[model samples]
Target: MPSDCTHEPTPATQGPKLLEERTIGGILVHFVAIPTGVAGAGIVYLLATNEFTKRNARNALDWHLTVLALTVVTFGSLFTYAEFTGQGVTDVATLPSPVSTIASVVIPTLLTLWFLVTFWTFFVGLIAMGKATFGTAWRYPLSPALVDRYGSELDFPSKWPFVIFVYVVLLPLVIWGVFFGSTDGAAFFLSAFGLLGLIMLLTPLTAVAMYLHGERDQSRNTDWKPHVAAFVGTPILIAAAGYVISRVFTESMYPPGDAMYVFLAAFWVSSIVYLVRWWMTASN
Candidate 1:
């Protein structure tokens, strides 16, 4: 349904479009976003040209982007923290002050954001759909104007949602599933795969964070090319690092201590690669 709905927007962009085309495209983007989430809106935003369609798609896209991000912050953060902390014998108090302090601060603020954005998207999105049907434009509250601002100069790839979705949603679920009381050979295989997936997930999350931050900072370069390159290349780097670690450790695939260093090392390498790509691209 999301794919079928997105096709309407792309074709209309190629020619002189009418009110009917723009209206339909706008409607499709909003409704598609409801089920397909951020990815659906992203596809429509990248392809659709008519101002009504593009603006609404971008607005929905940005809101859903925030929702997707907050989903991880609210739902996934504690799970991730438990995962790592559960591995070792250190007390939660022994964790760096920043870790505990940040969690305390983030948890409450995140709850507030959750409520505001949910209702904001619903009211605004419904109005957007209704108005678009009548050929009127509706913009979301507190929009960063991502499309209106950087859109002209940048060539944003449509694949961003795929990258974002995997990291933001899919990998976390997989990691949780694999480690759900793991044992023996199955544990080994899952651990190895999950280790790699976790490292890879960070790359996309950073990509999203950078884009959101860059949108606010005028000094940052807006080109999406380097981001695209980093995400594409980082997987190989992650896998290779995992392979080396697995070879050196041999039987230490289990977590807590055996695989912790390896996972951290791989994550470090990916972070380094991401920064290099960002610097080379002059991204902020």
Candidate 2:
């Protein structure tokens, strides 16, 4: 299970407690990832609509988009290289070369590290604002470089280009590559990516919900029931969709590789729905 360290603080009287009672790893798994997953979906929506080009919001959006892009590029390139090279495809019980083991383990470890760093960067920023004695302030060092190019003329698009890209480009290509490459690879990639996307989508919703509901009041008791509900509901829906996709693709049987593809697709669709709903509610 992931950590839940990103939970909102209670009343102002009590000192700030760590978001979760568990360790850092536990908080990452439980809290940080959920909202981050939701935010990822929002990013896709923004990219699809070209909202990143706005003058006011461009800086923050671009910074986050860059992070998303880098993550995709890093993981995609490593996986592709591994697949083409056939570095670790053979049965490990037969004693594969040291090079294969190194390549296989190194790539994932680096990716995991990347996730941890990115999560911490965002998580700490959020916490700092929450704990500020005066007004909230959060900053990212990379924001300026990311927003430098976009001008004021671009308007947010309704077409959702990023969502389309996820469905039409990234998800399909990754699924195809993984399904053909190895079953374990397919399962791992799908679950990992799907989980990541889920967090991106969820995180933003939580933020927006808190903002709208004015949940940060010092005197009021924090009600975490909604957050907990969303946390549990999102993953179960994703899993259910994965199961359905697996059954469909494998003639009522679950093939590990194809099931991953199906699950990811389902997860993407669910995210899109959530984003649209949130946007509508927020706008209204």
How many clashes show up per model? 0, 32
Candidate 1, after superposition: displacement of residue 100 in Å? 3.4
- The alpha-carbon deviation from the true structure for residue 115 of candidate 2, after best TM-score superposition, in angstroms, is 5.2
Report the lDDT of model 2 for residue 93.
36
RMSD, every candidate, angstroms: 15.0, 16.1
TM-score, predicted candidate 1 vs. hidden true structure = 0.44
Q: Against the true structure, whose lDDT is highest?
A: 1
> Distance (Å) between predicted and true CA of 125, model 1?
1.5
How would you encode candidate 2's per-residue C-alpha lDDT over 215-236 as one tens digit per residue?
2221254332233235335645
Off by over 4 Å in 1: 1-21, 75-77, 80-93, 96-102, 149-284
Off by over 4 Å in 2: 1-34, 37-63, 88-116, 127-133, 144-148, 151-182, 186-284
